[model samples]
Target: MKFMMTFHWVPDTEQRAEAIERFLRTGGVPPQGVQLLGRWTSADLGSGFDLLETDDAAKLTEFAYQWSDLMELEIMPVLEDAELAAVFGRVAKK
Candidate 1:
């Protein structure tokens, strides 16, 4: 499945900076089973989003846990447009 993960930096500027440095130093690796498809950050740098694909939900949780101390995260399941259209087609035919 594909997932969208949003990361919102903590309100403290210093802490957020430190966490970002640490993540960069560590190469910001995602948890096992989770593959990063893309990433984007807000212009102001307060928040970011990652597009990831994974079959194991636990891997997503573990990835979130790794950053839980530095930022708030929102994980959402997502489907591509063609996938949504396929679902709609099935329902329409039924």
Candidate 2:
């Protein structure tokens, strides 16, 4: 499954800096079983979004735990456009 992880950094500058430094030090590696497909950050640096693929949701939590201290995270399951259309079609038929 694919998931969209939204990260909203705390308003504190020091905490945000610490989070960035930690990530840099660790090479910004994603948790096991989680493949980071892409990422985009807000121009203001207040928040960012990551597209990740993983079969095990547990692995997603591992990634979240690493940065939870400095940022608020929201993980949402997502599907491609065709997949969503197919789902809607199935539901409509029922």
Candidate 3:
């Protein structure tokens, strides 16, 4: 399954500095079982998005916990356009 994670951080300078330091130290690596497909950051560096794929939901929770202290994260399961189309196709045939 694929997950789209959006993260937002506060305007506190101290918190932002700590988050940056942690990211620099860890490279924002995901845990085992979760593969990071891509990531994008806002121009103001206050928010970002991450696309990840994983089979185990627990790993997703763990991955989120790793950064939970620094930012608020919203994780949602997502599907590709073709995948959604195939689901609709099957439903239409039924």
Candidate 1 accuracy as TM-score: 0.91
Encode model 3's per-residue lDDT on 1-94: one tens digit a residue: 9999999998989989999999999999999899999999999999999999999999999999998988999999999999999999989766
Per-prediction CA RMSD (Å) = 1.5, 1.4, 1.4
Q: What is the lDDT of residue 47 in candidate 2?
A: 94
lDDT of 2 by residue, 46-71 (tens): 99999999999888899988888889
The best-first sequence of candidates by TM-score reads 3, 2, 1
lDDT of 1 at 36: 93
Worst 10 residues of 3 by lDDT: 85-94
**Which lDDT tens digits does candidate 1 get at residues 56-81?**
99999999888888899999999999
Which window of ten consecutive residues has the lowest lDDT sum in model 1?
23-32
Task: Candidate 1: list runs displaced more than 4 Å.
Answer: none
Give the lowest summed-lDDT range of ten residues in model 2: 23-32
| Candidate 2 structure lDDT | 0.90
TM-score leader? 3
TM value for model 3: 0.95
